[model samples]
Target: MGVRITYLCVILCTSCNGIGIGIDLARYPIDSPTSDEYLQMVNRARRSLAETGCASFPGFLTAEATAEAASEAAAKSPSAFVTDSTHNAWQLPDDDPARPPDDVRNVRMRTRVASTAYDELDEGGALKRLYQYDEFVQFVGAVTSQPRLYRLADPLGACSINVFRPGWHHAWHFDESEFTTTLSLQQAERGGEFEFTPPLRRSQAELAEPAVARILNERSPYRVSCVVADAGGDATAPPVTTAPFAPGTLQIFAGRYSLHHVKRVADDATRERLVAVMCFATEPGKVNSAEVQQMFWGREIDRLHVSPMSMRANRLVRSVFLMLLMISVATVVTAEEAAAEPVPEAKSEAAGEAAAAEASPAAEASPEPELPPLDCKTHELLEKVDTWSIDCVAMWLANLGFPELRTAFTGNKMDGVALKSLTMEKLAEDYGVSEEDQRKKIYYNLKDVLRKDNAAGNTNHYSQMFFWLLPLLGIYKYLTLRYEKQIEKAMKKYKKWQDARNPPAPVEIKTFDDGTNEWTRGLNRDVNLGPKKTKAEKDEEKKAKKIKTPKAE
Candidate 1:
């Protein structure tokens, strides 16, 4: 029994050693450096990174490992989503003219990138195996001098391989992570150098015009070199440096503090740049938002990964609700016009009596042609309301007897689409309509105007679909605004000329007992009261007018 137990113990020990033997740690040291050698190697790397915000070790991976890793990456490259897109560093506000046409903020970047999510790789792949190694993780912690380091908990973003084909590049952007470590598997034949400006911006306020302009328009002196080494051997010897494209090298960078970009690969280059990236977080369970995931990976990994609502999505929702509101308003206007038509005068009693007295039996038997239903002009004037203006919003609120809310809305330049996103709580918070009843009143009033059903509670899927369609409404609004000014000018001129020629009679103005207008009528009311006049009626009217006019004498 003792002999058998000893053999089993030996077998277990050998299996454990075998499990650890795959990662060749000779080129990449896994053991902590000794005290005497520490200052020359570890301390030097730490100091270089602390001062310059970037450090790299050359020939960290053997040629065979690099070739193997490159093979694995190349095999997966065909599945990467290659996308070309344009974006400015700063998001330009809608119709903001304050930003100069030639401002660096206005510059749009064009880049093509092929990137795959880490979850797509095989479990035993080279990249996955290297990242999962405990010794490798400890070695990284020691080199960076970070007290504790954790592999990213995010499944898709933990490890990724980036492939830069000819003419592909990564545009300048601040990284979301603090530290990024990359292993160069293969280098482009030409022009795919990594360039960066260290300590560019610490916060949004620091991303000022002059600072960005200096980096973009002027030659900056703070550009960091990709390759850096510690001085070794003779004291007088300069630390060897190489371009960032050197394969088999490992690079560690403080990407959060540095604004960096990969230079475009040469248009004629035959080789591709393959890089394996491993991202670490100081804390565990750190994950990126769904928008960032979609932007980088072309698709989200999970359906339940909800991100906090973004302004762009809000804009889309508001735009869609505004479109529905426009349709509702149009329906209300048509109904009001139908109701406002004047009642036609019956034939004069005296004329009817005389005609009866002189008429033949056949004339008396003939019936009068049915008077056509009163012709109501289509109400296109509702489009004139400038939803972005405070006065216009005030006019709308005033109709609801909440004129005091105008002060709250003053200086608000949000368009109609944006206003459609307002909730009762937000309305109460902003306008001091703190009373629950008052808030409910305001919400109901707006709801009646904006929606036909006035359904209370959470929005359904149909409502979500409507919000998605709101961008189409935005496009229509843009096109309409472009022509609205010209139309308003023409209408003003026509009104002036008509007033001058007509010299109107005095008329009594009637006021409603209740402060109610056509809009107060619910959208459920019938809007199609009667058919509009056909072209035949217009032609007959012109002929009758000509016949009634006296001849020139």
Candidate 2:
């Protein structure tokens, strides 16, 4: 639902005085900041982004919903404002002839938009402490130090003055860029990830080989616990290790060569990873192939970025198509009477016709929602708690393309913050008592009732004072002494929020065991990662096992 205006804009790249073939773009190494230095860097970055009317912020990439818990929500912001553009990059040609990609390339360019930033962070100015290069070099150097974490991708090659707003699920497919950088001017709630199957590009070739298919389908005998999701804080995934998405911490990745999914992150995980997409590509807008042009208008060789107006119109069509695609994927159901076979209830002769008759319709009440065999729903539940905050997590939900949890309530109570705060004051205006008594009464009433701290399940802003206090107390020298209580409280709130979003379903009470009164229930709780292996997975498995097991009788 973004108010996007797709246009026909050309990538005006500055070719370095006709640099020719045989020259791969030079890469710069991005640096890592010490823990202490990171804190300082974050504060400074925050101030800088805010002044430019930008929306940049920090987030702990983690799965822990409680405050201060490690997370996996790693992202940079300012995506809303960043313009769209195709990254001109390296592409291995197909037999020396490249096949183009499908979809539209809606490009936008962006520049620094943080509030109160240091003046002119360009080539001329260098960090006095690090004592390095000029402003531009220093910035480039900072990002280049860690090629995997901070890729400099600028359209048309050379890093120039630019910025961009990457939309939700910004790039559904892979990119040829070896790595990309972001500054996080504004962060969205969901539907984006810089995921890749590292070294998978090589494995994919092996996987495609006819002989290798059998080996890949076998169920891992040992169900060793693995990371289902990381808010950028958890790095259980192969290669990239660690979770936590700290803003301003530039990210770099070889996207094209990697089988990565820029996941459609749910609202719960959206608030964390806020990156500002910054590119320092040697050749900015040079596409790996003209095939990239085809992505704008699928299978249409004749039509393309011919006009900004036509591109805009085409964007609308694609948007509608995408909407249908999402819905279709979300609601696909199988009418497999075999897989969905129902277990029957038992009836006793002593209870006779009455019991048999009563049990019949009890079984026919409702059918289960036709959903994917995978328990993607459980993952969704875990996501809610994984991305928690004192705030209602509005941004995260929005990012997922889901409506806000409190949308109904907010709409009904629609008052600005000042009005809401003042309402609290008005609620406490009941006294002819002395000034001191009135103030005390209001304070007590407001504290104990509106926002009771000691209450078990109720909460408000007052109760969350501990969240603010613990993180700041002498930097809370002893973790054991403090932070624990506040952390637990925040976790509790997260649990509550999680529960509300995905309430448990009522169970069906039925006859006991075959005859021994051993009650049985089929817990169809979709509580696992996606649907269990579908036909596709089963078919692969069957094909693999066939080689070992006896063939058809």
Candidate 3:
């Protein structure tokens, strides 16, 4: 019983990482194949990927592009070339990652992917080369028949010129397809090994079962590394080996069904590996995830310099003006008559779609900005509390997962100095909390910021307070006096950010009964907040009831 429990325990642990045992399918010691089949396959896959519009690799250029896009690259789902239709291309990372994982590694120096036979596309390009130049395809065919690959065509895939940096190591992960080809464009100074464990390829029994556990728990998993390590089970087994790769060498390997990790480079030399991806799907142009694509939306940013305060203020003013205008018109006139206003059918349909999209499962999972308490006094008091703890608040917001604090409390620049001033002013006040002397002088002496706003564009003291509370209160009451200034500043950054990577979907103007217009983001009225009206107000609203025309409705 003790032995059985030990065996079962190993299986349970392996299951967590998806491994198993006692399986012939996990066979290693594949005496390198001698045929030229894979070379033809590689050439064909390359052509197919090129033929499709959406597939390509990352581009690593300046440090700025590197920082802004690194987190995104790792987060993206693996997308390979398709067979029939085009895909959205702008979402791919601007610069490939410096590491070996597809997110960081350069693919141009390694290999070109080719169309697979299963995709039902005719092979002539890289696929032809995979078989003719080398028996690469033959080696793969001998191992696993009909391996999937990215189809390559001209103009050869978008990123055929990028170079690979040394120490680039692609880690173990399941591939979208069964097989992948890495055509070496360049090698690292040292240590560019491809690693894999064969015991992970079981088909009949779940790889997470007891069978896979014993294999990894054994001591010889590393001995079977066929690419760069000694690939032998016992002392008698032949030492592990790898074929030297050149510009034309086509190296096909089992990826989807195998657990693999590329060895890191030893030196600082940049190694280039330009490999294209190929795959099969239930449909011709199935998408991966909506969140993945949103990353690409704001890539083409406009160069506008706006202070954080101004930006927040602009958004607040615009939102409030629009919101107030709407409420006023509906209050003065009637809801039906306001909606009766004429709108383009295309615009209406687009708005409907945008709303529907926002209401989707994917959208609901995204962050939902909470509206602050409607009472003005409550919002003002909260701002007073938040203003004092700029340091504490900054830390709190950071831990809350808000990415804006990259500079200060949020992204870019945070008005730390301005916060100190506000803290001092509040402390001097006789307000209930600020009146306490034990805390008063402690927060008052810190005025390092007020002396420094010589040309500070974000000199607005309450800018942070504005945004921090807008979602809850719907508007910033204090800054209403600085309306135009705030609006001008925010519009600049919003326009800039929009033009770049995350171009917001174009908005449409929807006019209401009173004298106001609102930007409709094409979202639906599905926010389950319930009938935006009170019963007493509903009765009073009947005196001016307005019926909309069916066409204009």
Candidate 4:
């Protein structure tokens, strides 16, 4: 009995100090820095990062932890904002006046990916806990040889889940941060591999633009490298059938100088490629710029830049406005209700007869009649807008009191197809409707009509609910103001640290030479690490390519 109990304990209890955080401490004793195992792991990571600008530790998390992280991400992924655009390797805008049309910065590539921000993740979840772990931070600092490392303070970009669904791809671009840390939580069924070049830029002052242009123009064997997880559970320079990391792999990469991107996920993939990006900065209170935050998370950095006093003032103004509006609405409603009286049956009949007698023949014989109620039955045509005619859509809009849209639709000859595809930008640019309130009214009402049309028993009572909820908006603003004030106080308390001048010296990065360098020897080779195709499929492709269209004899 004693022997059996010992065996069971040994089998079940595989971790030591990492139990709470779900780290596999037996294999990676990060808490025990003096241990030989810890030293070896750190040295290997440092060496790999120095050589290849990246190092990955597989099995960093236990199996249960990895699954939990993946599950948490999957739940929050529905809210992830889709970023689809075409830009250069530097993530430049489409039209750049600073660079000529033929410049390498003008070169375009398409990327369609989604990201779930740090604020979206559960605060008590495994991924969040791991990111906040002191041991993990210390380990990353040791690996990078930094004297100190601080987690990014950016609310949205501090930690985020990069989700690559089917047909999504991240274009070749460099990160803005000096280094980036990512944990592999899940893998797609096919494609989606990490590929990067070695340090192309030595420093901010000396950017190797020519070398970048070379890779962008010509993906030569000397410039690009493909790292993949091998069967022996290590990241190596060889083709593999899976993604670069198995679940529970932790990768620290110097992505600022090394251009990298995950390959396009295959259209037929059954699963998404999910990676938890854990960010750290050598300096304290570091956060992503407002532009980066907006691009990735579709929001600013918690609006922390606004002063608390100004925020409080704004809140006070909003509260007063809301109170006045609510009082006015209540007064109007009460007056209308008080002005009306229940008519007796005899008096109602008498008034109807009098009203009929007073109506003139010309008024009764008018060609245009009063519009009917814009009810669900009438708006049902909008549910299948493609099948409806322009006249039908115009009549509906006119009944809804949106004559501007009706005019725009008639002028543009915008049929149901165009009406269904109307966007805010279209309304502002193409049409003359510049007022945001009017545009929102037209747009959201159209959506609401469609929604009610499709729903089984939904009615158009949203406007009533909107007025009732107006008071709650003040409450929301007040709560938000209070939260912001607290955050403001906290931020000010750390003002000294945020303004500290002594920053760590930048790490030295070596640039790779194209001609004189031994390109064939190291990890900087363009090896095919994509999904492996069978020999039969390769032959079929070859035959298809060889059999070109025959020209006319």
> lDDT tens string, model 2, 1-553?
1222222223333232101211111221112122345435544544432232112223311112211111111211222123233321121223211312310111111111211111112222211111121222334333334222222221122121122123323322345444444332223355443443343333212221111111112211111221122234432333322212343233444344433333334545534333333333443243323343223222222212334445676666555543443344223343432222224467677777776567756476765555223212211322222223312233223333323233532333422222223232343342122344443443343333323322332333454455435334423444434578888888999999999999989876656544322132233233434323567888998788988898678
Can you give the lDDT of residue 527 in candidate 1? 70
lDDT accuracy of residue 64 in candidate 1: 72
lDDT (CA) per prediction: 0.62, 0.32, 0.34, 0.71
Task: Please give, for residues 387-440, the per-residue lDDT of candidate 3 as tens digits.
Answer: 433343444333334324323333322334345434433434532233344333
The TM-score that candidate 4 achieves is: 0.49
- TM-score of candidate 1 to 2 decimals: 0.45
Local accuracy of candidate 1 as per-residue lDDT tens digits, 1-553: 0111111111112222113434445544453232245336667667767766677877767667677778988998999877677545443333235665555555666667887778777656667777876556766777778766888876667888888999898776556777888988888888778876555546544443444454554332222211113223222311222236577787887777666678889999998888988988787677655555666677665533422333455566655655555454211112433324334569999998997899888865886665333222222213322233444455556557775675566546434445666677677776678777677676766655555333332344467567546645765875577689887999999999999999799865554456444443332245753334579998999999999997899
Candidate with top TM-score is 4
Worst 10 residues of 4 by lDDT: 1-10
| Alpha carbon RMSD to native, model 3 | 34.2
TM-scores for all predictions: 0.45, 0.23, 0.24, 0.49
Model 2, residue 271: C-alpha shift (Å): 7.7
User: Comparing candidate 1 with candidate 2, which one achieves the higher lDDT?
Assistant: 1
